[model samples]
Target: MNLTQSEIDLDLGAVTMSCTTDEVATVFAGLLREMRSAAPFIRPDERDALRQIMSHESGALTAGEVFPDFARGSDAHTTLRKLRTAQFIRPAGRDCWDTGEHIEIRPFARIVWDRLGEAGVFGDPPELEEDDIDLALPGADEPVEVALPAPAKARGTRSGAKWDEGDVLDFLNDEDTQG
Candidate 1:
């Protein structure tokens, strides 16, 4: 039997699955839960630091690079160290580091996060049919017919202007025509 939502096709490396949009959102919710349980808690300051790194022009930078004003052993420095210990930031090179998988999953996580406050998995409920809608607005009297203005005529040309190759050649050969 048909359902409210159509089946969405999913392509895995070797296996494929078809599910509705609601099902996909539900799966993402499950993933979010598992990821949160496995990952360490990120404090507000640490989140700000991560935001700086993510918005960095180079896409990768050292903790010192991110918070240059914060000296070693300072609170901000300690925050960076905590992020490192949590593996939220991974070393990119000798000194440069970048966001880890947790940050990478943010795009998908955001969708789930938004849905947390919603009643459904995602998207608004299906719209009610006009016949099914019982409530009427204040202006729900006889339908008012509107008269739209006629389309404006094309500019820079006469209403019935038509030109051929001969007309073009004549125009080009006119004395007033510049080289």
Candidate 2:
């Protein structure tokens, strides 16, 4: 019947292995907040590249795959190194950071993902083949169209009720009742 603030608070970090939506959202919110505060220090070119990565459904790619477009000549390598060092865009491999390995967007990068998703970040979904589409359950080829009964006009009444305002006059006007 009663609870303290600590009791109401959920310890998401303790059970991250469970991977619940609430826990994930909490993590994302924290990351977004940190990213916002750090935005002032983050370079414009790095920001553009990060936005592209977050928008990508795969959410990752090798430096070779993403570079050249985002970073213009000489300073590109230096900029990328800075980003990697700062952990803004991280390396996929534990041993090394290179063209062969992917640089993934952080799991909490949902802000960028949502923004890009709304702006057409992902391509159209793959079309299903005719055989792949299942219209109904097994052994049921055609969908059963259910026709609902017409709505009753009477207010404050339902079907199967012993008394209905709609039929009150009929009961009152019965010959036996009148007699």
Estimate the TM-score of every prediction. 0.32, 0.40
Model 1 TM-score is: 0.32
Candidate 1's C-alpha runs over 4 A off are 1-4, 10-17, 34-40, 54-64, 67-106, 109-179
Instruction: Provide backbone clash counts, one per model.
Output: 0, 0
**Residue 147 displacement (Å), model 2:** 80
Model 1: pairs clashing at backbone N, Cα or C within 3 Å: none
Total colliding residue pairs, candidate 2: 0
lDDT of 2 by residue, 1-179 (tens): 12222223445785534444556567756665565555555577766766676656543577767774344344555656655554456666754455555776554455455663512222325657977975656868655543222233134345555555545655456545559
Please give the lDDT score at residue 143 for candidate 2: 50
User: Relative to the true structure, how large is the alpha-carbon lDDT of every model?
Assistant: 0.51, 0.54
